[model samples]
Target: MSPSRVTYAPVGFGDYHWTVTDDDGRPWFATVSDLEHKEHCGQGAVAALKGLRQAMDTALTLRERDGLRFVVAPVAAADGGPVLPLDDRYALTVFPHVPGRAGEFGQRLSEAERDQVLDLLAELHGRTPPETTPPAAVEPPGLDGVLAALDESEGPWSGGPFAEPARKLLREHEATLRERLAAFETLVARVRGRGAPLVVTHGEPHPGNLILGDEGHLLVDWDTVGLALPERDLALLSDDPAALTRYTELTGRTPDPDALALYRLRWSLLDVAEFVEWFRGEHQRTEDTESAWKGFTDTLEHLATASG
Candidate 1:
């Protein structure tokens, strides 16, 4: 498909996006993910690319082999793989643009939407995933970065406009951040020690990745798909007691509160860690950077709130 025009889509976080209009006048969504930002398996661009391929391969299998309709997996490239390495820094993938109302990142699903999502998750959790599926992350990919940032000596960061401000914010919440990290470590130990049944999970089942199309709700962004405890997906609905109960009814497994808290805290710290590295690297004050700055500060506030 030859792209006639490519319009920048300033939607979503972490990855860059564009809407491509092919010669046939069809729309395709293009996602460019920074290989460095993802650290689920290990460090470096190579490991990041491997982890991404594992996840995308699992998604493709689920959709094509397992017959999961809700999963909008990536389109395979010329090499018969979904991932195309754009450069050492970024990777590219394309998907058929689902024309519908997409959900917001932090928005809680409504009752009907929640029920549909829970049902979809139940089916997903019960599936026998492909052998290539990697294990779900016990901790955030960027935990080391977060720890390093917290342990750094008091000095101004030198990435770009947001560097110093990010440093100052980190300093202001140093004690709280430390406490939260300690608490997170404890939760991780508890959750792992329990030996809960692991299944294929959408790491971020939050609203932003759901698109309500003509047929029903379709889940996009399968980058986080991996074998993990069900709570990893259910953590999105932790605040909604009714949803939790409903999920229990559907799956006949009681949701673990400690597990829920563990993932919730993990997400906050992940955001903090990602922004720290972003500001510490070669960055400039573009629209994305500015938005990342707000995300950095907001997540810190969220960590404090969780602590309280």
Candidate 2:
């Protein structure tokens, strides 16, 4: 909590935080995620802070290349330019907290809103230097690979002693999920082997990453931006069926069945585990725990049905 730059305090709210000013002064929204950038994880893990700063650089370069001039790092970095600190902490150099009830195009977008998001996402996907391929999937140090390494090794925290119900589902479904993942191993390999058209994508684009700005929208939280199919964003958009329908109308095509399935299973499992973590105080909340539990169970059931 530096006096000069009040981005977020360690003891305060969320992890990936945003400081905004409203009627009662400025407060922040903290998102708990595993993108610890200022500090390294294991030997090769990139820090979240470093990742966001890097993304800021990429985005600004794109904006300028397209002849659009905008501030890069808006708040914690420097003069509104995003930059990494000497200690490895990322900072946004410019911000003016404003007051208002608002929402982002991601949540409930209008036709115009849809256009704005599509444009921004499109810009992100464009302009990667041809040879700049996605970083190779770094297999975890010990296990057979990343997928094989994904586990349900009892999160560090969860609810109290009252027979945490989700645990059973987590166990039962994780086994099922393991099977499902296995079934897709060869297909996943083939898909990657195809050397398909890939681009920088926001691996996750939950509502908080977007903001309503004076010009239109300012997509925030670029931590998870990475190399992936463009449909990754589209798949997330499909999480809102109405949005999906509208988006379909706008784009004049149907969402891919496979991508939807992958996004559903992937997002559902990840969200559910984090919910369990939140139950144990290992994280914070962006959505309800009950909703997560229900969705998680539903997704598992869907997987089971598919497997059957």
Candidate 3:
């Protein structure tokens, strides 16, 4: 498609987005993912791209082959691949701009919306995943940095404006963070020991990724897609006990509290680690960094609250 215009869509985190209009006035959502960020996939650059390609392909299979319509997979490029290498530092993928209202991150879904999502998730969990799909990640990316930050006896980090503040925050909450990490490790052991079956899971199935359109509730963001335990997806709904109970009724498998806690702790730890790395890297005072600073402090507090 020939792009007549391209405008940035300042929505969501972790991936750059743009709305491209074709010559025929058709709108398409363009996503440019940073190859260096290993948050979604478990590795950097090459391996991350490979994992993402496999994940996107699995998304396509779910929509086209398995007839799972809720999957908002990427549109294949000219090379017939879901991901197109933009440069060494980034990759580009285009998606059909689904007409609907998109949800925000951390927005609580209503009961009806929750039920609908659980139904979609149930259908997803029941399907057999593609062979190319990678295994779900239990370890959060950048965890080593979080641990290292806690070990540091220095005054502050030297990344940029947020660096010193982030170090201070980490220092203040070091004890709670360490305790939570230990609890997380224990929970991870329990979940792993259960020997439960893994399934294709949308790693971040929060409201921000959900699109309430005429077609129905469509889930965007496929980078974190992988084969994992049902709890990985169900854990996002831990805020609502009823949703967990309903999901158990639908899938006939009760969600384990330990697994749920593991994922919850995982999310907070991952966020803290990612923000720490960002602030420690060569960054500057920008809108994004400011946001990252807020996220950094917020996640630290969230972890502390959980520990409390």
TM-score of each: 0.92, 0.59, 0.96
The residue pairs that clash in candidate 1, if any, are: none
Return whichever of 1 and 2 wins on TM-score. Answer: 1
Candidate 2 residue-wise lDDT, 1-308, digit = tens: 23433455332112344464445555534333334322212222344444555555555554555543321223344445454343433333333443343453237555676666666665555546223223322121222322332454354225543125555565666666677666555445645565556666665554445666667666554444556666667666554445555445554545555555555555544544444444444333444455555665676687788678
When superposed on Cα atoms, how far off is each prediction in RMSD?
1.9, 6.7, 1.3
lDDT of each: 0.86, 0.48, 0.85
lDDT for residue 201 in candidate 2, whole number 0-100: 68
Clashes of 3: 0
Residues 98-140, candidate 1: write the lDDT tens digits: 8999999879677878888888898899899789789887778
| Model 1 spans with C-alpha error above 4 angstroms | 239-242
lDDT-sorted candidate list, best first: 1, 3, 2
For all candidates, the clash counts are 0, 18, 0
Q: Which of 1 and 3 is ahead in TM-score?
A: 3
